[model samples]
Target: MEIYGCSVTDYSDRYEERLNLYKDKFEDRDESIFLEREMINFKDFHNVLVSIFNCFIKNNDYHKLINDPQFINHLNHLQNNYNDVFKELFQIGPPLLDANKNVSNPDDIKNEDNRGYIFYFDFTKEKVDNLIVSTKRILKYLNNKKLRLQKPRTPESEEEYKGSITTKETKPPKPSKIPAKWHALAYLIELKSKGLKPPINTEGAFIKLELEAIGRIKTGLKGQGFYREVSKHYKDLDKPEILNKSFGKDWKDTILKLFNSNIVLKEYIDKHY
Candidate 1:
């Protein structure tokens, strides 16, 4: 016999004993005194069981029970035993989106369906577009400059070579030999001060910063590849709030002034070119 659809095995021994006593005294015989006592015991036991189950289910740690098949099965059995109780206590269906709408077609409605509506949120793509443009310009400049620097070797006859024993100048200018990493670090510092979040990888961030600096110094050193590379890393950092605040304007002016100071750029040109 089941009370509230729960089998005898599901209840504690005391509860089972009280339930059995109630059934035997109330239904099979005319012992009203014993029946009343056992009935009250059963009701108290059921309420205690329900309270304990409610506490367990409401706990945040109860989510761990999902990893145990036995626990999950036991929970399901308990749920079935007190289906009406459970239904009254918690939501049993998919979540609602806002008070008026159900989230039945989340994927279908996600793509601009509510665009232009006051309830819909839209992002301005202007900053991303400008980043793409500037990145491309810088990259193009770098690639072009690299190509131009590749010198052609002239072949000489053995007699001419022997007659002219002068040593070929292969030493790079002192400024060109200055590590590109330093330039990159300077640029990163400037960008950071202006609220841009630079890449966590120091080497990668420095390389990109140096490329942009190089592009600024040489107008003809444009390459789409350089732009794409720098833009890719820059966007990955994703601190667009800094750019949106027009900090790049001041950064650009400051970098230009430093470039013209003949302290860094002059040194680089003398060594490299």
Candidate 2:
């Protein structure tokens, strides 16, 4: 059975672990020494990373791929949907050890485009499942990292950067009036207009946060609880009678107006919320 838009089986149990590792790697905090027994190489992993990003590029949905919770869920669903393809590919491979046994140094495998051989067989259901966990974790980390980087500079930081020493204490900046949903909605609609599809998974963490910020849902909801609430919300919205009354008959036009403006969604959301 499905909860919200996600199947219970679709989520990886290793999501949090993968997320932590992804953050450590992204921030250069991971100092763990590598071991040959790990059964994967830097080159092989790097190729997977490249392949993931390349998929986004080929679809012309890199922005959505990174920052859109729905899009991320869509990617997860796609990966899950290809289970048969993965199983079939894994059936035809000679052991990778045979290829590596001759090489004393892993570093000797330079500038190698081994994705053709590696991807085809390297991913058993279990291995791909682990990789899927890592992929989602990394995507979430990168998106949040990008958001943090885009956050507006505080007055104190700005002043310190300018080397201005003021004898007078500075007042804190006023809170912004904008809500987080607008930013999410704006981006979502833009991607839709561009013919990019987002996942039906409205229960994802980012979407939960956005909905909570708008007072449309309660805070601290997650997993099955989160999915149930969002699913109920969507069920309500799916009724044309309710939808028309809530957004008016021209809701699509109203939404288009909100998203079509050229303002940077994240910047405005950051500054305000």
Candidate 3:
């Protein structure tokens, strides 16, 4: 399954709590955090669909699939035919119902590279069952293959789909996203530069915020005392009215509204420094 594009979120217990935490927090938000989790869940849900379709495709008989060149040829030959049945789905690089597909826009992928992709789709149970039934019908339609491998798929035939989707709608355009992983850090830097507080806390709070910003890509930050001199910093901005006026919506909407924004750590000298 790993070789076949299973993801860390699919297998590991390590990130489960964090992932589920985000799921619960962002459940009602329009933000990508919740949506991406749902999409990944949808992708994983298709494992059963893949298994059933693949079983029939590989072997007409329920219990067995063998290394016969005939079935292999039948699968390869129906490339053009399958696309017809899955007109909308096969058109993009979604991990939708297509057993063989890749990301339409690799850069738009939201997860880390080590984790598999999160593919957004309208994954209602009815839709999936519809696709399963359609695909199965096609497979059954193709089951009476009177001819065997006339010739293996040409290099050109395989290459054709590699470039694009089989449908008329263009691949979904790349969505706008926070430009970098340090989005939390960059936003925090901006907040502190503006002389913000609530931003004010103990040194530990500051360190925790800084870590949230630059988690994997560690860099020196202004050490604790730089920002946590809570006495020096004016703390009135922690009020909801001011927060709503500050960022407009997102920050104030959540319960962690106060310090959920990033924190400060002293800018320590490092090799990069």
Candidate 4:
């Protein structure tokens, strides 16, 4: 069963282990040198640090860390000296939730089946507020450097560059006729006036009149041939009704208008000729 956005069956013991590690590190202030030595990579070190930090934040006891004079002094020193490094290291992204609404343990996401829960941090919330502030400051500095490197351009030179490129104008292709029922004949006529082509089929006419009982076409004899041609095509049309049903009530009119319009019909004639 799915729970917390992930399958419950996929939950791993690693999640519990990570959670316990955070609890131990924060609650006991564990200062084991082995922990530091074991974290050989930046990723591993960041994970351990963020997990412990989150545990403290989530527990709503920020004072515990703040009250420690040494930790406070270290935090202040880092903010002043290596602020960029601290932001990069501590900006944890959004927590992944399982189908059961439980925050996914980062370790569990290493598996392929559980990968979907991993997402970038949502900047609108608490996860990256501090990080966002730091990023903005870094970006401002970079922008100033970029402005220094930029060179001014003359309008005459810009116009010459643009004139060197050529553009081609091509006509759009004509739309195909769609067949419909005889009860839809009037609708088809309205479309024909607008330059649309509606393909009528024999079988569809019978179905529309007998089964669907759509109203009959009321146009004069001059338009009879066009209606009959469409009806014949409708009977012969090979596609499924379910697929054609989505064409909408006025689709026949739209198609006929496109078929009758010189702008559209010219393309069809050009293609065939």
Candidate 5:
């Protein structure tokens, strides 16, 4: 239900129907499953991803999601939904080390418990620790991005008084990243703008093509001959595999590079196109 905001967008009615069917099929049913629960937990993963992107990617804040307790709790909850709950997620207190040894309490002197054996934790903590280190490095980079934490002016300086600006330097608003589901639409728009032949046929066909390409919906409406005419004049028009899976992920980046300097086209893309 809450899938729209994170990554994929512009869901077709048919796709939505398929999504719900899958959801119903998995829920409250005892069946051999490997990745079905993983798919359900995708919603949770996307939630965490969206929040992290907002705090880190959108704002470029020095504090990453790794620093947030709520994020940790959310991730832990998600893990509990599928992970083995018997295992410990973390050890609170630091390991007491007098030397390269496990310091045992002399009062509860148990010979087997005092044995010098080092047991390693599971992959979960390893992943979390890696994330922590990575976030620290990434935050350093974010902080280095042109003095990230700029202080607001209180009109203390003559320049500030003369300018009478209400807030700090406001950069121009960037165009929002177009959704992956709408990549076909955006591609069509771009083609039309450049006076180039449209890919496949109509908008409906392109939408179906995109959904099938990304494994979203499988209606088997194969239009293999749709690109016949287009393919004669150009390469890659006929190949259904031309748009790889990451086509939607980095489609904007790829398309924008072609018209990055074209201000008019860029504005049009940000608005109507």
Candidate 6:
């Protein structure tokens, strides 16, 4: 069954076949129920991962499946299927917070009784924390690798002639524009990593990236709404009056603070402001 818009077919036909075989041979006698049962529960990001992992384990090729094309396909499909889910998680209110009202450690947040919003995903806990931490690690790793691969190549300089030809000064490379939502999420991740809770109701929350602090702001009713809100804020940030009201007159310096963490956002601010 489809879960978060992903089904067994999305992983791979072969994997689905194998899953069916296992369902027939091992646990469920009802093929329809086994095939159609929901695999992901939005309250717990770990559900899909665990279900997939179980599938591999059932096939007795769990170790060999690493880096396998089909396995990667499954992960990619999972990522694609859960894209909206990720967006929602990043945008919503009642962020996970520790007893000190700071961002809670992923490990500490694993217990079902935790007072954080994430606890609603799976009441059982059950590796949910690991899923969150591992997902961040995997995303960061993939994002960095993608950045490296997409970087433009510089041409080799011609050998300088002795006092015959002058070489022109090379201009500094410009930063590419990353999605504003991406930069915002990255900043949020940075705050979480540092044990800071992102606030859910403050304007100019983006400025917190500069101060290495987390400010409050309600993202919005949905991921798209939140993105639109932040995008508009980012667009209007250049105004003197808006800056004066949201941040202090020293907003220029405050804005520069974001540059320290998110290079692409800094570049965006520089190019726009």
lDDT of each: 0.38, 0.38, 0.35, 0.36, 0.37, 0.40
Candidate 1, residues 123-207: lDDT per residue as tens digits?
A: 1122223323443443343344334443334556666566554545634223433233333334443454345543234454433
Model 1: lowest-lDDT 10 consecutive positions: 116-125
**How high is each candidate's TM-score?**
0.19, 0.23, 0.23, 0.17, 0.20, 0.22
Q: How big is the positional error of residue 217 in model 1, measured in Å on the Cα after superposition?
A: 99
User: Which candidate model has the greater lDDT, 3 or 6?
Assistant: 6
What is the C-alpha lDDT profile of model 5 across 77-134, one tens digit per residue? 5455534321233332223212354333333535454332122222334444444444
lDDT per residue, candidate 2, 1-273, as tens digits?
A: 111111123323443454466345434212111111011222233244345544444444322334444434443443454434333433355332233443323344443433433343234333545554554544454444435544555675564658655544444334334333333344344443344432234554333322332222212222234333343434333365764664467654444455464455434433432
Error of 4 at 153 (Å): 3.3
* Candidate 2: C-alpha lDDT: 0.38
Tell me the tens digit of each residue's lDDT in model 3 across 230-262: 222234333546444544555422312223433
lDDT tens per residue, model 6, 91-131:
34433211354433344444453444334333322343445
Q: How close to the true structure is residue 6 of candidate 2, measured as C-alpha lDDT?
A: 17
Clashes of 5: 0
Residues 139-250, candidate 4: write the lDDT tens digits.
3433443343232333566656675643353232232233333324434334433553342245523322211211211222223344444454443233435314645545
Q: What lDDT is reached at residue 143 by model 6?
A: 45
Q: Which candidate, 3 or 5, would have the higher lDDT against the true structure?
A: 5
Which 10 consecutive positions of candidate 4 have the poorest summed lDDT? Answer: 1-10
